[model samples]
Target: MSGKSSLKDDIYAAVLDDIIEGIYKQNEIITEKQLIAKYGVSKSPIRDALIELCKEGVLISHPRYGYEVVRINEREIRDVVDFRILIETGCFRVAAPTFTKEDIEELKNFTLNECWWNGKDELPALKHWENNMRFHLKLISYSGNDYCYRMVENSTGLLTRAYAQRFWDQRDNRAWNIDIEGHLCIIRCMEEGRFDLAEQELKKDIASFLDIICPNYARAVDL
Candidate 1:
């Protein structure tokens, strides 16, 4: 990437980080002037970053007012969760038998608390979410299908941002409740050459996301 392009990406990530970290709340207006001042950049890169965010559905553009952070609803969250189940479980079924001992070991590492925060100083919730995403993406990658990997990556990104936006104040509580033990069960099933059981555990892991987001809501899949 060119220096200018790299700068734009950096600006984009910084703004998105603010949004996911709850520095920018849902439906809040963000202006180019504010970002330019914060990043100490010219208007060109700032506008480019805002446009990219708008295209990703993270922000909506207003003619003269500025950009507004978009709020994710329960229905949309369910749709993303359902899509995750479809893709993640399907990929695991194809990829589980192909996993080697090394892959299994790496997956097990994600279950460790320190693996998510070895050197990073990010918020606990963001670190936890990053670990969850890495685990799932790494597992799906064994499918040897780039298309499937990209799909899971994008959907998981949406879910992560949604979780932060929805429960910013309760992030720590929700992050701690994630099903890390479920990941262990999946890994064990794979280690035992029980791909069938592993696939089932994968489905449950994806559905468990709903419990974290909406404690009282009924999941579409019966655990």
Candidate 2:
């Protein structure tokens, strides 16, 4: 990449991290001057970063004004959660039939170790979240379906950013704690080759999460 393109990517990554870390709240106006000073870079990189964030649905741009953070919408959160359920459950269904004991142990160990970092008022929570996602990604990595895996991974960054914002505001621990148990349960079911049980637990897990993140959205599974 050219120097300009590299600079743009760096700026994009920094601004995106700030948004995900709650440095910028939803629907808040972001002035170019402020970003210019914060990043201490030329206007070119700042502009490129804002444009990319807009494409990611993390920012909204106006003709006369600069970009503003995207507002959190219950409907949008619901839609994303629904999509997650479809893709993630399908991944587990396909992978569980052949999942091995080693796979289960790896997932279990990753989650249990990561839980230690949670509940400590960490500023960015990205490390904890990344590790948590790794467990699920590993479970699906052997599904022999690259498209499904890639789609889920790509969608997760945006969805997780949205959820993290809400999670920080509400300070709800129930959903977070459930996430830990849910992963463990899924691993156990897969280890036992209980595909049906694994699918059932996966649905419930996503449903509980949807309720937390988008309470007004349609349920993922009929309760």
Candidate 3:
């Protein structure tokens, strides 16, 4: 990427991050002129970033309103989570048998560090969310399925931001404050070569979040 393009990508990422972090709420209008002034960039980068956001379903453009943040729905949230569970659990189960002791230890360390950083007041929620995403993506990367890995990576950016924004908007709870003990449980099950239990735990973890975000679907899935 050229220097200008790289800067544009950075601008795009920063704007998306702010939107996903709920700094820009639903139906809020944003303009390229404002962004151009805020980021001290030209219209090219600002326009490109807005277009990218539009493509990701994060923003909508109208003739009268420039661009507005998209409102999330229960159906979209549930669908994303369900898709994540299917792809992630499948990846984990397939890769669990191949994980080395070193691999497991690394995962354990990452989880612990996340727990530690989560308790620190200086750590921003966005950083915690990013770390949480990295931890899961790293695990799935081990599956050796390049295509699946890329798909998850791409879908996760948009889905995670949407889920996180809605979650924080509805509740004051911190994302990092989640019960990561479930992660330890998953790691232990994988270490013991108990793939079935690991899969079950994974489903439970995903289901718990689904219940919070989309209770009706969670109940339906349980039934």
Candidate of highest TM-score? 1
Cα-based TM-score, every candidate: 0.85, 0.83, 0.83
Candidate 2 lDDT tens digits, 95-210:
77676787678767766775434563452455546655676666667687889889878877877787767766745554443346677787677777787998888777765656
Q: State, as a TM-score between 0 and 1, how close model 2 is to the true structure.
A: 0.83
Each prediction's total of clashing residue pairs, residues at least 3 apart in sequence or on different chains, is: 0, 0, 0
Error of 3 at 181 (Å): 0.6
lDDT of 3 at 39: 84
Question: Can you tell me which runs of candidate 1 are displaced by over 4 Å?
Answer: 1-3, 109-123, 170-176, 217-223
Tens digit per residue, CA lDDT, model 3, 82-163: 8888999999888877889898888888777754454545666555446656767877888999998898788777666666
- Is 1 or 3 the stronger prediction by TM-score? 1
lDDT of candidates 1 onward, in order: 0.80, 0.73, 0.76
Give per-model CA RMSD.
3.5, 3.4, 3.0
Which is the better candidate, 2 or 3, if ranked by lDDT? 3
Assess candidate 3 and give its TM-score to the true structure: 0.83
